[model samples]
Target: MLGLHKKWCLGICVVVYGQLLINALLTTNKTWNELDWLDILGEGGTALLILLWLYFILAARPGGRVTNLMGAGLLAFFVGVFQDALDEIFHMGASTPWHSVVESVASPLGMILMTVGLYFWRQEQGVVNRQLKKREKLFRQHQLVDTVTQITELNYFKYHLRIALSAKHVKRKFTLLLLDINQFNRVNQRFGNAEGDRILHAISELIMLNLRDDDLLSRYAGDRYAILLANTIEAEANVIGQELIAAIEHFAFKTLQGERVRLAASVGLACAREDSVDSILMRAKQALALAKQQTNSSALGQLVAV
Candidate 1:
């Protein structure tokens, strides 16, 4: 991603500098006396603003529809203001009509494109906000989040689970679910590690979307996730596991080459007992193994009691 933004920055620099050079060469007879500080301030400021927009758009988002449209709009605005700023410093004479046309048309057209881009961006943000609402109550430390999956790591998850388990006189049953992506190594081998990470991230989002607001989801390790279902029994946990498995199976994740890959999840469920966290986790891991062995015939792994 850094490489992608670096290329964009280089392209912007080249275009802006190249436009200035061309303007300088064309204004062969111009004197420094023609320079207007006010015009330079206005047009140059606009150019700077357009560059800022481009930087924010590229830096904050992945390449997608909103980014593409916003990038194009900013590029158009940059080109427009770049020309206007040059025209103020140079006497283009007979070529001034073309310059006026470009300056007049490009900025407005760029604004219209930017408006459309902003509308789509708002829609995208709404979806993000809803997802955040679901996960925010479970945990709220932004710094401890995993970069690749954008969820909490295993340690934080364990910390919370231990707290929930120790609470006295809670009527609701607490269950732990551990899910491993079946044949996930094949995805990395076939589509490369980057695509495989994308798939894992997508799967993590899918799991969050399917879970209740009270549930805590985290990346346990490579190709595995740990979920804490507060106030859920084994029967209810099994149902949630099936839903997650179905969601992943139905998800048509595509590779960079536009090839769709189907996915399967093997889940293990274990209810909390009067034992240490390590013991409960071991039970879930053992159940997960059983679930993986049964993945061919069952949609979800077997539920094991402690």
Candidate 2:
């Protein structure tokens, strides 16, 4: 969509430039200062737009040889635009050495910067290609599954759960932790949806940092998150719960008004026996309800058994 829009805009620019050239030729006054502010603004604006379009294409497109070639084309486009914009804004008469020097240097500098950007872009694409190959096996496995979205959700749960259950089934011990942001709706109501989104992203990053690579983390619902721990009993889960509570307690988030505001989370944990995933999740939710029910709770955090 962006590419198409850019092409249409470039076409309009060509038409306007053609009309301006014809007018310049037909009129008696052909001097440089005869150019109006409207012409300079229109031509300069078009040049800037072309440069912007080139930058977006190189920066945002997926990595590949085709993208590399497109990036090179963008470099050429930038050179053309730089020269055109300089011509519109400056009078490069035969006597003005500085004006000629500016005109000569602008195009080459644009080309050099664009070329450097493309080189790094190509290297970045190589890294992306390797990562894509690693994910290909998982992608194929996903195609065999009925629900791809569900499998993605289950990736952080079932994958870890299988390892945990296999290692500790004989002992019949494990725990599930559920964490929810308190008064999250109030943030959206008071500030705006954009502010709410930033809070959610920040909280998610914080939770992810606290977990082991082997642990499971999932965004279970809006303002709610779940974690499944391996070989962890109710007491151990409670200890982890306290650590999480401390982490959030120490966090100070900045509001839209540039004021510092503190936020808290309510957590619930449940120990697992010979239980299925659904059962464990249900018990964890119940524990979370109990935590939220506590009175005079500076911060709500609790642990319970299934």
Candidate 3:
């Protein structure tokens, strides 16, 4: 992730270098007896810790306005703290008032930027939380999260499926959509497993983006996604399934090596009936198999004609 934000990293490096140059040019080294070891230890250590935190933050998040703002704020704070540490070993003559300038200006500027960044971060989380409402249905289990897609696992989906079946509501039956990515294992064989995992994650996010606010999504089997459309009927869910298939058809996933990988999705659509979880799943699976067969035959026809 840090490698992805080269411009931000480069800008911080420049600021640090400029500060070092200014300090060296304007300030003279203090006498050995004049150096305050205690101040150096405290201020210097703090600056070091902040620098590490900046690195971790950059590594964790993608490049965006919020990330940029936070990185810039941390860098500004680093400059001020680092300059304070320098003050203990360097003589800040009357002509060189940078010590006062850095302490008074940089620290406050950093704080202000950080505060603004946090405000935007909160708004971002609100959107994410709304999306997750359909995912958990007021339930949470950290262990059920999938390693590849970071979505909930099959067991979690099954848990919710059983509940939806037993509960009596105006809309007694919910639509279940199972999507299997075509030739997923082939992707792992051609590219590395790491690249395949990235594709899985990408496809999962794409599906989530196309779903309604009240739909639950989870990882099922190796490369299949199970979606519970709580508020959607079979006809509406069928349209959504076709939309998902079309979306995947048009998606051009660029690999780390610059190769473009176009993906296809086969969706199985079924509506819930009674408390029969196994039957519902079996119907969906059968539908998915039929869809896959059609896709293969179509591809084969195209190749023969070409």
The numbered model that scores best in TM-score is: 3
Q: Please report how far candidate 2 places residue 188 from its true position, in Å.
A: 2.3
**What is candidate 1's CA lDDT for residue 231?**
90
Best by lDDT: 3
| Model 2 spans > 4 angstroms off | 1-173, 295-306
What C-alpha lDDT values do all the predictions have? 0.82, 0.61, 0.82
For candidate 1, the lDDT comes to 0.82
Q: TM-score order of candidates, best first?
A: 3, 1, 2
Positional deviation of residue 67's Cα in model 1 after best superposition, in angstroms: 22
Candidate with the larger lDDT of 2 and 3: 3
Runs with alpha carbons beyond 4 Å of true place in candidate 3: 1-128, 300-306
Per-residue lDDT over 155-217 for candidate 2, one digit per residue giving the tens place of the 0 to 100 score: 445555555655644775777888877777887887777877777777766766676544555
- Considering only N, C-alpha and C atoms within 3 Å, which residue pairs clash in candidate 2? none
The Cα error of candidate 3 at residue 5, in Å, is: 22
Stretches off by above 4 angstroms in model 1 are 1-130, 133-139, 296-306
TM-scores vs. true structure, each candidate: 0.56, 0.49, 0.57
* 72-102 per-residue lDDT for model 3 (tens digits): 8888888888888888888886877768898
Candidate 3 lDDT score relative to the true structure: 0.82
Q: After best superposition, candidate 3 residue 291: deviation in angstroms?
A: 1.3
**Candidates ranked by lDDT:** 3, 1, 2
